[model samples]
Target: MNDRLTAAQASRSTAVKATLDYPVIDTDVHVNDYTPALEEYVQQYGGGELVDALRKVLGSRFNTRSNGKDWYQQTLAERRYNRTLRSPWWARVTRNTLDLATYTLPALLAERLAEQGADYSVLFPNDVLAPLGAGRHRQALHRAINHYHADQYSKYSDRLTPVAGIPLHTPEEGIEELEFAVKTLGLKVINIAGGVKRPIPSVADKYPAADHPEVAKYAHYTDFYGIDSEYDYDPFWAKVVELGVPVTTHYGSQGWTGRHSISNYMYNHIGHFADGSQAFAKALFFGGVTRRFPGLRVALLEGGADWGAHVFTHLLDRWDKRNREAVHNYNPANADLELLENLFQRYGKDLIKDRTLDKSTLLLDSLGVSALPHSRDPNEDEIDDFALAGIESPEDIKTRWVDSFYFGSESDDRTVASAFNAKLNPLNAKINAIWSSDIGHWDVPDLTEPLAESWDLVEQGVITAADFKALVFDNPYRFYTEANPQFFKGTAIEQKLSSSHTK
Candidate 1:
């Protein structure tokens, strides 16, 4: 035999060296959305009109800006630019389109996983998520894409688990899709968009008037922070808890309105996932969804764990100061009008002569007596404020914010170590940092890089081996298995998990 070893052999050797007692489960791996049979599924689900709509909606020139592009007569260069932008850098670097086989081929992907020493991976769709939108065709679109995703991983279910995409524009639709995907499709994990679009004037009022000026073709999508959301969405959360599938959001703020600078993709990409996940987590916590659905688990995918740590501390900081009781201190009613008047008269005799300081205008317009705090009880209105939902102590924040949510961190992220830092997190508690390799995407050049990069934390003394184990394996295991204890029942690591539990 030759003394030389293949690249796969070398990667396998490296993975063996870094092996942990627990199996590594990557929570956010992506799969290619463009299958040869995608259109077939679309047609089968009565999404022929949606296919026509998609064909009519011309693709964006910039990969960063996808919404509201002219649907007709797009230039060839624009299409070429978008396609080039979306392709992986490795393919460009190697100048070989076949490098994509690592993602496209199930055998190759499994080999790569074995080389990385990862026991399992949860697959997400990149392009499919964008098209799974709301409206008349939502159910059909959701069904088709979910069916395709299930088919993609059907044979590879031993090592790969595809997350079922469920739309949340309506609770009834969301519930129906969840049930169908889990029961009929036999999908174990479910993924949903962290945010929703608030159709202005509600879907009911807008539908009656098709030609109305207010009725735009696209609904004004907003962050679901619950501060301004039109829907309660408690029923959806209840369904998630009822079904035993841990909910994950691969949603990000990539091609949205604010991030729509046509110049640079990096400008739109930085911290986009973090922003989306933070908004969703905050909405769930402040809206009292977590309090109501205590058993519910949410994993914010592709965002680093640092956001989780920051958002948790930030919420407490805001809650400590922004409560109705604390805000009452700043009530305009508390301002002494008489004292201010005396000071104004003493300090501004020249201004009075010039008619600069108008007392009536100042009181009526600037600090109106009619809008005083005494006019309405703060306690009575406190119930209306979603942020003040029975939030008495740190326990509430810890339970609702910390325990209920898990952060999906890519292996290549340096900030992954921060999730394990007790000092950075609140109450010396750790945020659940689930390992998400994102192997098929541009961020990871090599399929094996994610696991190797994550081990850098251990080599740098950023985290202990035990901490790294939790980051890669324990946290992911807990996130999924806690929702459905039989999550790994037939998987490769069921024995190891069982042994650990027995011990």
Candidate 2:
């Protein structure tokens, strides 16, 4: 029965692939690292003590119960007592044991690519991602994990490629790891955290985290790399563009704001990645990263594409109402005080008959002086908030938003239609939505299910044939190749990419 089920799954996806002339590039396929082997490398870098510490503090590197102390180990009462955010359990596929093996074994994954209907896949490595949460030992652990993945997956470069995790807590730190991961280790792709959680200035000034860990955890803000960061991250971004790599982030916003439900994991999980992606996108757009580096390509993964389109459309809507010229429509200085008073006298016979109210109070209220006596309006230079974004027209927003960013929509996300809806998007622009088969995770369950699932969108006429091709192939191709022309150099899809005029 299991054999039949597996065959049926593969056949469906394979049939979907047969309809496409272009090769499908699964941009966000996940893979796990063998924990025991990964820990050996971690020990090599941070020693036995580090391994023992991680085991006690984080459980084990890839263990489902690992990473956090509160949720899994704690009783329901204890979880409630601490307000601990629920952690994920059974994140990997175990019932489909072959699919489970395929994630850890790169060679096996490469061999099974045809069944999954992907010619090539960019692997998001669980081990490469493991080190970033190791705190003080992260820099060393990152080196350990990167080296491990390079050793394990380099041989399977033809079909499967793993992304090296670069922690950008600081720009210098990120550049150092990127240098090793790409230049030294020859890893082609990289994934970065969407934002860094930093201590709020007022809170950190009074209560140091070491002195007050519980107090400090909540007293923090996320510094989305492009905006309001303590240190300028331009050096890191410059290095990224200079290195010919696209900025891809798989960050999520769990335990952030409303996502901190203590018992239900799904409560914390739903739309968290989208929230993180939106935060990152807003920062990049408003902070002038897109304006400064027009060629920079950023892919926000697993959030789906609708949010990007929503942001784009809203930017146009906001700019229309609040551009440099339109904003003056609400200026208090432009209000006719005499006309207002005459109208008030005409309309306020009974309302103001008994009152001897000062007319200047009305003027003060109209000028907004009565409400905000403390903080005045911003400087002339600061009046235009969109100045940093350099959005002079809708075209500018389209260029900056569409050309600079790609959204990763997983197979089952119906909201992906927003990406291809040219009429709905601002300036008739279609967002660049890449196909991401989030296999090996709990959401996918079966490795062969994604391509067929995505194909169903096309069958239902939710998106056209060309739109489906763009989602599955062209967008992913452009996302990688435009960032680095040689991104697919030695891979199976390299020839197909070079031969096509798809970009």
Candidate 3:
């Protein structure tokens, strides 16, 4: 064994004794891309043209290229950013995670995980996230990436479950890939981009006018979430329910407006994932996607649990302030015309002569007004308000939001404690904050330290043993099984379960 691996294992032994014997299921482990195999899959799947297009748009190399010339790859400024004062000290302190073998070899990863005190991990692909930038060939490229993952990582099924990448540029394309990835590939987990492309013709003007006018007719930028979305993704959400596999997103909002500056990498990196997760989640809730398909569950990956708490509280707050009866305060139809006329007479100098209020031709009084907020008369049987699903109480909002969403959090985030604190959430509810061991990433230098870092919360009295158990094991198990009851069927987790089925 390598010196680092031995040290990692030794450290894990000390950490595991802190918590009760609960099987850890890390929902956000990542795997390095096997480029040659991915390329082969593209060729076999008749996606050679798509690959060539990707090479032209992005640099040809699959893994991150350190040329210092390519803008998309780490530029000199970004490299310097990683090396300079605060970033450099942080990097040096964190252990080396770039070693290819540590991530590429499944057996090594399994051994490393065991030494880290984790019983199981779900592997996600890094390079596959690139296809979201492509317009024409995204679906084909995602298919190749998914097939490659299934082909490469199936052997590690005992300890690692690989996630299938599915692009959501189009609902039809998403459904097709969903079926292929789940039924055909036998892959269990699904990862979709945080946003989707606007359907053709409607969002045409968002594209650059000069380049490929045909492509320009379609939206080049991705829609942040489904709220007020031009294209309805209800079909895709329904299809996911039918397929019985949960969807997750590790997408980020860096390189976009607020995070676009190149001078500081930290400026772009910090909270980028949370920004994306928040927008996507809020959109899903306000758009009524959760209401339409009650069984649809999504986990936003690697973005900490604190944001989930914030979103849940804010959704309930909005529902309270903007529900049908409450919204009448803002409705023009409910305005007291007589009181407004009296105020205008008392306060108006220039408007009284210019706009004469003839009781015979009073414009405000003459305007058509619905007694109900959204065209439904209050006297009728049903009220058609802005909130379509008729969220009667705050508990309804809490139930819908909490049930439909799960937040995947890194072990080290200080804010993760908010997820466990009922006082911090709406309706005194607990948000689903599943543990994400981000083992292969730079944030966790030593793979074995994640469990130790997470236990710090319990040590500090921020959360309880029950909260830690749910965060590390129960929540993730429930999310995966909510989609597929057989998710832990033959895995080590199944054997550890006191009951045959997941609770």
Candidate 4:
């Protein structure tokens, strides 16, 4: 037994120990069963040329030759374990013992929750959005994926809030899916890619011959492109605010322009999101979406927070000037300022005093700063581990070792809170930052480990406890629930033990 214990222990012991009791709500994690899930939906519904293209793309990634099995069979065998593990309604109905053990029964997640004391967790689909947007799918295929995610939510309840995936080929179709997602699936979040195909101009506008210089330039930039445009998204955003659902852009793995010229994978994928998201945010702001539907909220997932801060400041500066110019435009004839002053005398107080207006302003203030957790690949574990532990003063330990499990304790001990406050002070107290452990991504280890590491950073004075809480619990809770109050009930954990419970 002693020899076996020694053999079982390896170099990863310290790394594992350091993360054993960190409380966390992993906002990003994935489960991929792409080929089978896509194929089954396609085959059962209808397989057209688009379906064929989907098969070819997915087959290249998951299908193998040695087995000589059909794509569905091979995919099923490979992904059966993960599929069963997912807390989808099918799993619940079938009572897959493995899924029940791992996800549904709360045994697997609860163990981690108990150790780290995590209050809640939100789940996003890996196979759905990453591939769904790449090609066109039959309407039925879209319905199947949507239904599958809905089933996941029904089975797991708050433990997994499945984000809905929309087919963006047409604005009408996007709206339809959005409606079903909220009404049928009870989906709180909607995920759309950074790209959508633009509409063609009318025949009369086809002007100069096909070979015209202007035509060539236009085609090079906009022709047959599958990039998402802000104009096309107006209707969708309108409905989102009406229904009170937050719109999220999950950065797709594939590049938008084309595969060849793209240099770094991260830069290509994340760069497109940054460019697209910035444009999207600008359109919503200037297009008067925020002004129109003041209650609406938008979240940029996996996109870093620093960029959001930069963009908000830039927009405020620009808007202030633009508003001033607009006032000048209607000046003397209408006496714009005096007219506004007269109007203000009549309605300004009423408008400013309205509760809804106040709420909308607050909502915009919160969304002006969005964020994702700072992630370091597990390969850099050593540096991160050392940094976390080194925060403790030797003399402090003489009294009692700090309990890293408690949220915000590390931040308080190491002055991390003060630093975060100072950095965010310029945003006019509109710091809508949240902490997320993009856990379950292949690059990240189990959730608890990172939470422990974050605490270590707090101890080292890298981040504060209040900021840590905001990142991990408070911010996400407020963003998901407050932005759209009806969708999420705060996280609740219930435990059930079997008559003959076993570890």
* Tens digit per residue, CA lDDT, model 4, 1-503: 11111223332323433343323344544444435555665565565664675555544432222234432444545444322111111112122332223333333543343333344555565556534533455355566676766664565564656677776666687889889878877777776664453324552256443546334323422211112243455676678777877666654323244421212334344344445555555444444445445456666555445445555545444344433333344222333444444555567576556543343233333234342123531232332211222213222111111110011112112322432454553334334444444544433433335556656665666665666666666555555654577554544522211211433
Best by lDDT: 2
TM-score of 2: 0.93
Each candidate's clash count: 1, 0, 2, 11
lDDT of 1 by residue, 1-503 (tens): 22222564667325643556677888887766554577677777775686654333314312222233331233446644542223111211122233366566666676667665588888886655555543567677778778888886788787998888887776777889999999999998888888776656675375644565244434556747344567667777787788898998866776566664444567767888898888788877777778888888999988889889888887777767766566656655567777777787898677567766665555554455666537565554663343544677766888888888999888768887778888877789888998888877777666656787888878888787888888888899999888988888888778667786898
lDDT of 2 at 15: 84
**Higher TM-score: candidate 1 or 4?**
1
lDDT of 1 at 178: 92
Instruction: Please give the TM-score that candidate 3 achieves against the real structure.
Output: 0.80
Per-candidate TM vs. native? 0.80, 0.93, 0.80, 0.57
Q: Residue 78 of model 4: what lDDT?
A: 47
The C-alpha local distance difference test score for the whole of candidate 2 amounts to 0.83
Cα displacement (angstroms), candidate 4, residue 102, comes to 8.0
After superposition, candidate 4 runs with Cα above 4 Å error: 1-24, 34-38, 47-53, 57-117, 130-138, 199-234, 252-263, 266-272, 320-323, 326-427, 490-503
